[model samples]
Target: MDRTLTTATTAKIADAATAGSAHAVGLAEWLTRRAARAPHKPALTCNGITWNYGELIERIERMSAVLAAGGVTPGARVGYLGLNDPMFVVVLFATARIGAICVPLNFRLSGQELAFIIGDAGVHTLVVGEEHIAVIDAVRTDLACHCFIHRGGAVPGWESADALMAGARAERSLPVAVPVRADDVAVIMYTSGTTGHPKGAMLTHGNFWANNLNEMFLWDMVSTDVTLNFAPMFHVGGLLCGSMATLLAGGHLMLQRAFDAEAVLHAVAAHRITVSFAVPAMLLFISQHAAFEAADLSSLRLIAVGGAPMPEPLLRLYGARNIPVHQGYGMTETASMITFLHPDRSSDKLGSSGTPPLMTEIKLIDASGEPVTAPGATGEICVRGANVMPGYWNRPEATQASFTPDGWFRSGDIGYRDAEGFLYVCDRIKDMVISGGENIYPAEVESVLYDHPDIAEVAVIGAPDARWGERVVAVVAPCPGKSITLEGLHAFAEGKLARYKLPKELRIVDALPRNSTGKVLKATLRVHNVATATGSP
Candidate 1:
């Protein structure tokens, strides 16, 4: 009854199987190995439908076969435009199975922005949800694609994924001929660039797997843990930290189309979810929900929050409610959580993003490019680890500028690590706002305001808000000899910036406070914007 392969035998088997096949360090193999070890374990559960490890692996293989049959090949960019669903997870693994890069598009992006990412990635086949069929149709001419697959239902000339998946035979794919290495690019996630465009960050399979292992190591997760993932799949935090981590751990994942506080709480109680990921906004809603006092949330063993800082009030609420949430910090360039504050320390640290994960190295560097070696110190945060992305797609200048000579990623955010290794972020080098837990780069907003004719000069900054965390505030200098009002400025930006980035308080003045050298000082505006807006003439 000894069915176990010895260590040497296992190594030999792996060497023989992966001899010429691409994806040597791939998650496809990970799924198979985990399935063989525990086939009955649940891998995904969405809207009451469940798939075990065995079933999940089979679906991935079949889907990959369908993709390959449809002409997807190694290095091809396959785009996915949908909300979070099991199919999104399936598409990720399927694309990786063949060494193709997965491009996850934001569902909320305008058709023009979506076109840029799809075109930038050179994606030829897009898999979108039926909800976006109209949106995709509007921009299909701009998408440099050959075909499309609809996730929810059928569309004209586009294959229906749900139907195809239902009819597709479940069988493991024949081994790929060439091995996909750890360094091979697995995904391309688009980040809003400084130049009013989006840049695709090329992340390898190793990047995704390494981050998963780091989180797994930090939390010491077990098979019994169930993670509820309501974050958007297109983002690194959602696909990697939320869903991918669950699959990598061979645990259970509960999927959501998007973050809905009531739905999230219901899923937790219904599935008895033990682990979960949420941003500060989602956590705040849960804290303020009517069910907060009634719902038995004791099933949650661990939680991680990111995309914004966890305010002191919210952190205290979770601690008092017996649901401690670890704060994590990272960006699209770094595969999800670069550093994590474990749940146990959620209450203790109060405001830190915890220490770097096991495989990651974090350093603080002064403006002179020298490392700051102690606590209560502030400097630009630099990270080096397997979880770091390979580079941006087709952006050599950006890739070169983003790193130090030695290889550490130079994060523009300023933070300091305590003696105990907890990271405390103070300010960002880039003028960005984390209003309602979403990144709002001021440059993007400023560009929107620059188009207004009445505005001679304008600057936007994040101002404190009691309810919304941070609200975008814009200050404008009226053109000389021309008259303009705050209401007029708000009307110009109403349709331009996203609702969250829309200026909450607008100030029209004779001149925006600027430095002597002619640089608009944002630091000065943050204070003056509040003072001047009190009584506008």
Candidate 2:
């Protein structure tokens, strides 16, 4: 019983990992507990189907037996390269039941991009979707995935997931051999590679348990609550936090394959979903969607956002609509949200990323490791918690450099904390654009540019320049039937930002390039060889 901590206080209890010997404990256990307590309770709802606790556990058990019969073993890397699905949950629990580590691959990644992650994670058994089956087949020669379980529909070199489940037993029929430990790696979520190739963040069982416990403390969760989690299952924010967080409360998860605003709104109303989590970009899409005004989104109690920042305008819009939106902050290393914007401070603290999660200890430190005491003094955001990942998978040097000597995981984000402890992110260390010896943050510029009437979407990137080292350029998608001159945009931004911070060049387009999750893919944009001189500075 956690003899590591001598205290029995509630605060210490808040940090305690769930009672378990191993980290990679099967979802079967969690399901069994809830089923025993309330068998009829809906555990998951998706695509016009609702699965109760007992039923979900039975499916997971069948899937686990299927995987075990297919030669899956302890420590085996089972990769789920698919979008969000109820089947993903089955795969997740089934992988854990046999003591295997689940590697959920992002479907949005290109074949080459996915190949790197597959090789890096040593994923030999890939359970992909029909959409990614061709990509997997194309890159199968180089990747380690020998056995593939294809969902969605049938494809060659892939066994049907439904067929496997049909043939397998619906109970834990195999003899227990390897024990699931609380510290064993449960998931290896690849970080969103904004800068380079994605690195696997090895999240142990304690990481998830801690995250779940911290979530209960920071947010209101109950067994009666139904969560409409539209976020992709491949991401830690979705799989670990969004999905698992709902499970921890013995609540229901309404699964959607992807974030379709009208669909999500329908699900929330249809399923009576009490909670929802999404990225800032998703929130923007939902708010901007044509059916926003007509949709009944009132069933949503707490709508949490993270992954990226939303401007204050969006916050006001959500608040006006009766959905209290709280912005959360974390990385793959923290399992999900090491910090979340509290409901109370959602409106009171505008542009703030809220407080650290109950189990987390956060500090802002400079290059010298000295703490920044001032409110506006931007420093690196470092987090220490049970929720924090042990290290990167198979990269000791990268892991060692990722933390301080004392155990804080160094987040490469520049942010400041207020006296009340709310965080205000300034910029990413890697994303900071330098022009003519001047420092500029794309977020700051982007936030200001977002306020303009003509702009639909805007991305500020550092363009390669032989003279200024890197010039600031704004690539924007304008609203339909509306246009803004490059000089006019400069004139609008000039007062809000410094001269170097203002976009020296403005390029209008039909649409801005975005990642699979709708995040502006700046790296891809930087390689865009389009240059047009509008009436600019």
Segments in model 2 whose C-alpha atoms lie over 4 Å from true places? 1-28, 152-154, 171-178, 192-195, 432-537
Where model 1 places Cα greater than 4 Å from the true spot, the runs are 1-24, 166-178, 480-499, 530-537
Against the true structure, what is each candidate's TM-score? 0.90, 0.77
After TM-score superposition, what is the CA distance of residue 350 in candidate 2 from its true location, in Å? 1.3
lDDT of 1 by residue, 10-120 (tens): 343345444444443576666656555566678788877888766666666667776776788899989998888888888888888777888998887767667878888
lDDT of each: 0.77, 0.74
Quantify how close model 2 is to the true structure by its C-alpha RMSD in Å: 11.9
What lDDT, from 0 to 1, does candidate 2 have? 0.74
Best by TM-score: 1
Worst 10 residues of 2 by lDDT: 1-10
Task: Identify the candidate with maximal lDDT.
Answer: 1
